[model samples]
Target chain A: MRVFENWDTSLKIPSMFLLMMSMALIRDQYLISLLPCVAAILFIASGLPLSLLLSRFRAPIVFLLFVSVFLVLFSEGDALVRIGPVVLKSQGAILALNTCVRVLSVITVGIVMIYTTPLSGLSGKLKRMLIPHILVDIGIMTGRYIMVIGEDYNKMKTARKLRGYMPGKSMARRFGVIVPTAATLLIKGFQQSERVFNAMRMRGYGSSAAGEARSYALERPSISSFLMFLATVTVSVLLIVLEVTVETA
Target chain B: MHIPDGMLPGEICAAGYAGTAALTWLCIKKARSSTEDPARIVSRASVMAAAFFVVSWVHIPLPPVSVHPVLAGLMGILLGWISFPAILVGLFFQAAMFGHGGFTTLGVNALSMGGAALLAWAVYRLLNRKSGERAILISGFVAGFAGVSLAVIFTGSVLILTIPAHIDAGTEISAILAMAAAHLPLALAEGVFTALVARFLLRVKPDMLL
Candidate 1:
């Protein structure tokens, strides 16, 4: 949870947004390589367990490989490998590889953002924006209960395990149990929502308890944060322009 | 179909985000103006989103291939107009937690899934009048099939528009069609599954079906 907690949430998000945008736009594979290296440096600076940080990406890297294959199999290029009559293109392969790097880098930026900042910090900033109160409230709850749902899922999985259910059953029976269980979880979750809503309503959730007009103007973020965001944007734009210029030249 | 990161061109993916945002905003506006309590809707949407996150994570077996159920029909019927936000929230968490999809690709994923849920809701609404096993089964089939079928077409269309054709156009088109075709079995399975769940809900809490 505390992987990159040192950085200011308000500062980190905008910069990361710029970084992701830059990564998405930059076509130069070599320039794209620098993003992940930067992410690694940030992670190393955070002093969280290197193993845990790396483990977060293991599944995704595997998945990226699978998806990148699609790009490799279908894009234009010279043939790299052939199976019987089927040929894989070299151009396609490089395109897929470059894409894999960008995807990974973008995800890395996202992970850095969410991990460094507390969810409340992000949501609190959101509330200060013109976003609807109900939307923010729902987002906060969703962020909180993803773990709750995950725990419930694990418990169900354990219970199924304890029952000595054999694996490799008919597809119908497998999803038969799963579909109903998901429905049950949903029904239970719905009931919980009703209780929570009732409790909030009892406390006058939507009414002008604090009087919405009394709220002062939102505080500006720190100068350092603003500068950081500006710098990120400037650098990202340069990266994009440099890559495009190089491509066109 | 969960289109993972880097599968589509960045431009198409960007469009996906914009499309999802506009649709989600519309759904939110509509939901807010509805007679239902906003607080109640938030709570329901949150919990439903939780359900969606869980269902998406659990891999279901389909004999030849294992696939995650889109559950668009179920989400559409259960959450109605709120399905867009609910799906968005669900997808957001999934991306954050499992890296199931990427941050940039989120918009397209949401559009494909949430768009289909909305479509499914409309299909279900059209069939809600007749009350019987026959009507329920047909409704369920249509909802489930339309949900996945439309999602495939959307996913395929996005990739088609973004990816350059050239020599790969034939292969890419085939790939898109194959992806859509692969989901056909799952869509049929979803139909049967939806029918069963809908019938169960009908007996227990018929109001939910409505």
Candidate 2:
């Protein structure tokens, strides 16, 4: 898919940076939340397709359903429906609705951020943030190699399937074989890494980057955007505090 | 176990964030002493990262919930303190990329998930070195299951601890119970999956074991 192509390199950094900052801005209440939700809506409205974006959130949506349905249907509140042992309450529904909205809002904001920033930028940003370079580098390599190993696994699976290797009553036997195969892949990956490391050493890999990589300047924040973000967070937090206080009173 | 944003009470989240940061600082300090060589450091970090990356994505469906093996313990056995950074990195990316978790909760996830790895490392050191195979596998199982269960319990207990005093007793109990119930299958599945993956790793690269 076009969206997936060079996706990590395209829009991961700025989006992630924003996400991190925005998270800090979110308060315990609706004021901070409403901003992100509204921002997500506006972001969706501007050019991004909501359906396509929502499609990215299918997993979270399913999880929300399973986790929240019981909570929403059982607790006491304004009665919506009651069938013998089952009781659906308005309060419960509202609780479920709020959770779903929060989940969607987070997912939407993440999707937009990822779609616009590059993966390299995310790591670069982390390094800039004074996060340990070793951690950042390890994360980058892991993401890169997981895809590598995954592709290797998929290819092996296809080859095995071609040879009449089907999972069935002989599942244990197949599993036994899969272990050795996966090990071989692990060894192969290690060997490859060794060679790559050697090559890098010969080329003086760490010598230059060691010094140059210490710091990178952060992006300049726009005054208007910063203020808007602050306003959203403040208002959302207040609303949530007010709601909880009123409910208790 | 990733705790997404807004999933729990604000107080619980705040407390978790604080607790997580303290533990993470301790882990990082512990890791600092062992970073004598660039090669060793890089390999340990890479392997831990690779293990976590592999485990995070390859989930199996178990009826109501889904689970992937928690290689945290395995990572610890193989990579020691380096697993800390690897985990920190993994949790950060998961939050930034997936929004399956929040930025504020990153430290908490790393501590809960990575803490198991450190614990596994400590436990492995206790068992006979000859039973390294069995030790690693068992450590993996214990850490995997414990990681999932403890994280949930910790998260749940935190909620209980931080509930606003004004919240009714019923609302408090139900929320706590709901959180606990939701995590039941995940713990079992994580334990089983961890055992299998550990077995696979042992067979493939016995050298991976400490």
Cα-lDDT of candidate 2: 0.57
Q: lDDT tens string, model 2, A1-249?
A: 243223333123334334434443343345444645555654653366767665666556665675466555654567788889877777767656666665566556556555554455666666665556656667777677667766776787789789986644443554455445544555555565565556656776556555545544535545554554455455445555555665566
Q: Give the TM-score of candidate 2.
A: 0.74
Error of 2 at B98 (Å): 5.3
Give a tens-digit lDDT track for model 1, residues B113-148: 899999998999899778888888789879988998
lDDT of 1 by residue, A115-190 (tens): 6666645655655554456666777788777778778888888888899754457876776677666666676676
- Model 1 spans > 4 angstroms off: A1-6, A129-132, A149-168, A208-217, B4-13, B57-59, B64-66, B164-168
Deviation in angstroms for A172 in model 2? 3.5
lDDT for every model? Answer: 0.72, 0.57
Q: B1-210, model 2: which lDDT tens digit per residue?
A: 466554555445456557765665666566657654454455556654654565456544565344554556556665677666777777766665555565545656667677767776676556425554676566666655665666666656553444222335676677677776877677666655555556666776666655
Docking class of 2: acceptable
* Model number with the top TM-score: 1
